[model samples]
Target: MGLVIPFDDKASDPGLEALVALVAADMNRVNQTILARTGSDVAMIPEVATHLISSGGKRLRPMLTLATAALCGYQGEGHVKLAAAVEFMHTATLLHDDVVDQSEMRRGKLAARLLWGNEASVLVGDFLLGQAFRMMVEVGSLACLDVLSVAATVIAEGEVMQLSAAKDTETTEDAYLAVIRGKTAELFAAAAEVGPIVANRPKAEVAACRAYGMNLGVAFQLIDDALDYGGQAAKLGKNVGDDFREGKITLPVVLSFRRGNETERAFWKRVLEKGDIAEGDLETALATMKKHRALEDTVERARHYGSMARDALELFPDSAPRRALLEAVDFCIGRAH
Candidate 1:
């Protein structure tokens, strides 16, 4: 039998709820900005954009922008615009990612690329990215603009890096970490850092927010890597073993491949490197991963980063925002259970 990690009821969890409630008002404004900016005379732009935007993603990146801004004592509407921009950037990336991965589902629904075609999905992603930059320009903070723009560049680079390394069982942990840092964590770091930048908080506070976001983003991706093998489809919003099917070299795969014996390594090369997956291949992958404790160790790595994320916030005094942020870390790691 495959390893079965017990699932928790996410709806009853107060950790994310507290973060949501804390950012509710600003998030409303951010939502309005998103709606307003998504409109265009070209009908397909709205069609494709709204398909993914309306999908039930938690909008965690934008929430980070709002939460960290508030935590830094920001008292203005700029963060709302910045937050919306962050969401647009994230949504744009998802559209592009779906096309790149040839993914069928996203956020529990058909991927925009699948429904609208890859061309439309890619174009709409570009439209959203253009809108994101427009919103960033409107915010009139050169520093914030620079942070997000650089993140956009870094994300594209990361995607290319991952693509080059895809299906290669020889992928190292350091290379994997570099890919995730560029593809995922850079935006998180920018999102959090902008909050302090807009709030005119001290440089130290800005660095703290950036550190917290960077570490949290790493933990978030690691948990997701583990979940692709262990988590249920309903909670994951995608099929279990999607990464394996796609031949993606996530952390769990990296660890398992590195730890496997000669025959086990040959199995990995056939399945992942050659994409010769057959019936029961996923089960074998999971059983091999379990034998090596790959999933367990991947979650352990996530917890290490989660600890760093929480410690990053130690520079701040205790407050509702701080506590909420801490709980957010737990919420992320708890998904593995």
Candidate 2:
């Protein structure tokens, strides 16, 4: 079930909006940087890249970079370039993921791979990745570059780990966490940590920033996993059973599989491992998750990590940016509703 976050009867909380408001000016600069760097003489590069970039993603990771850097009293323009680099990296992953998954849709429209073909999609993704690294170098901070470069490698490893784990019913919660930590949290931690590093903050504060982003990223991905089963397709910008069809062993699937009986396990193996999904299979899967409270448990886990993210920010003094970042943790968990 979607977590019903009580927010004065509002459909959604104002936390992300508040965070966006706090970083509006900096975010504009980041957007400008992104647009400027994405251009290429080859028409297809800009076409594919701009199609995905113009999609209505919230750009949360880059905003985190800007907010964290400002929170650390950074006065340099490096944060803008770093924020743009973070966005490019995220976009690159999306392009690569769609191609690997053979997904038909992205952000409620035809995937670039579908429109432009897989080879173009992969090559454009590589172009974005190269541009992301070039921007990282322009920042001129070896520490920042180190963090993001390691994140890039970790993200690739995570994609591979997920590929291997797909359709494998034996995947554990710990293994799933490791996959998401690499696939999602590494960039978040690097994005946040780089802020403090660029600002020349102390080690402890930088560590705290990294901790905040890591926990927040975990919470973000956990909520996403929950929403795949509970969320509306329109809000999700894809079909509800996309994950099930792909046979990806997300947390809910893992929990349901582990708790299921022999008959249920057979059902999972038929549908997931063998990709023999038929009519009513998704409904059956939902019923199984509900029976075992898998979806609810997954959302609860997200709340736990969100709490950790908030707690990590305790090292920072009270300020508008800090409040927004704390609210972002709430927003990340709350969005599942």
Candidate 3:
């Protein structure tokens, strides 16, 4: 379906292999169909779209869309259209985010802003967003349209909150959770929630799938935050210091700040507030994390929600797809990038 991205290296986890295969096959099919529909008049739009869409993302959002559809008893292919819409919305946000952050790079390549300038990036992002809304209308489900519209709003709100909250070291854990829910988890929730909505399933089932996506998204972001310093910069593709340099407060930083003593607190205040974070500050931050067992605590929280996600999937039939969906919880929690 696409290049294999092993979520975990442990040889014993065959379930992860199965999950990755299914998710990748389903996601690639959606991507191909969606890009082709962009048409010739928007040639430059598709060109820049190709740069971001073909840049080798794992397509977790689309997978969630498909999995939720299957879990909710959808036997048709409409899930593919919805999944593609979910991905388009996600990619549009990424384009806008890079511009807003003035980021020169993403996934180790020149960002759309860096390669094509802000006007192109912003316009292309708008095109993708409009395309997604058009796809939702084509689905001919008012419920699906409603879910996506709300999700789009939530994603935008999260981005705004993140921009405002990043500079404050006093950023509380609750605030961090809210920002991620808006930026990352809201789409995950919407992607999954739309599945049942499209299928016209009972409300409780839709609620369960939505819960699964929400918890899974939070867990996924938590691990991603942990990997900022705990993971290899080469493996993550983006620079390791990006979060610190951008002053983005994430789970690891929240936990570290919670446990910081006198000097560590001062370090956070100066670096984040003054925007003068130094090379040595990174080591100091890492040490603070180690001393307070912040990483371990955050990992535990991720797993707890991962467990909730698996539990939510129990409403599904005991099929191969269901098993694959269940395994995704663990994969999302442990992924390095």
Per-prediction TM-score, please? Answer: 0.97, 0.96, 0.91
TM-score of 3: 0.91
lDDT of 1 by residue, 1-337 (tens): 2345543324333459878999998889888889999999999999899888987888899999999998999888899999998999999999999999999888789888878899999999999999999989998999999999999999999999999999999999999999999999988889989999999999999999999999999999999999999988888888778899999999999999999999999999999899999999999998898899898899889889999999999999999889888888888888887
Candidate 3 structure quality by residue, lDDT tens digits, 107-129: 77889888889999999999989
Ranking by TM-score: 1, 2, 3
Clash count per candidate: 0, 0, 0
TM-score of 2: 0.96
Q: Give the range where candidate 1 is weakest over 10 consecutive residues by summed lDDT.
A: 6-15
lDDT measured at residue 148 in model 3 versus the true structure, 0 to 100 = 89
Candidate 1: where are CA atoms >4 Å away?
Answer: 1-3, 6-14
